[model samples]
Target: MQSLLEQLFAGITTKSAEETERIARAFAMLVPVDTTLAFHGDLGAGKTTFIRGLARAWDIVEPVTSPTFNLYTLYEGSRQLVHLDAYRLDSGADLDSLMIDDFIRSPWCMAIEWPERIADSLPEETWHLYLGINDQQTHTIRLRL
Candidate 1:
């Protein structure tokens, strides 16, 4: 698992943004629900794309769009994916107002972009997905999942 994680980080330094998203979502499909995944990356790092892929992979037929302006989008699949965008969150305290904690403890998978904005509120067992810019059009995808 350590080796796989290392490879994932290395991928961020070499892979295209779309490729990174594809891999991240595909990997996410393997993760069980009732888990929180925090995505750490700057703007345009393909975080939204990754979430979209995850929704599709999970069999969500409806369109998947980033919850940036909306905050969170709930979609149904074999399991539901609660996608949250923490970019506008000032602190973890904001999470409680949104009732995010309840979702985390349930049988739904959540993918949050800009997690650093609400890192403190995140559960201890949450997985971390960090994206690093390696080029103008490429990004590294690192997963601690």
Candidate 2:
């Protein structure tokens, strides 16, 4: 069995945003409820696209957009999905002001983009996904858990 401290890294190549979304959908099917996912990548790296797949898997029909200005957005369905964008946040206090702890502790599945900004506030077991652009404008995804 894998130890809690052991990290997992899985790499996959996606030639298009749609492929990236499909990959996210597969991962979505396997994630446990209440899981926290931290996304790391530059802008236009398909972070929101991955979350779009996640939202679709949860049967949420509403459009999913980065809550860069709002900080976070919550979608309700059979399960609650909490999407947080830390792009504009500069400190843990900023995340705290949003009552981030309450959301993390709740049953909602939390997906955070720009997580490095609030790294100290994230749970130890949080899953991390990195998206990078390759030479052909394809996305290379690295998922660590």
Best by TM-score: 2
Which clashing pairs does model 2 show? none
Per residue, candidate 2 scores C-alpha lDDT tens digits across 1-145 of 6321232254777898888887777778778888889999998888999999889888888999998679789998656899999888766544567786665444578899999998887888899998888855588788787
lDDT of predicted model 2: 0.81
Superposition-based RMSD of candidate 2 using all C-alpha atoms, in angstroms: 3.9
Worst 10 residues of 1 by lDDT: 9-18
- Per-residue C-alpha lDDT of model 1 across residues 96-121, encoded as one tens digit per residue: 67886665435688788888887777
Scored by CA lDDT, what does every candidate get? 0.73, 0.81
Give all TM-scores, in the order shown.
0.80, 0.85
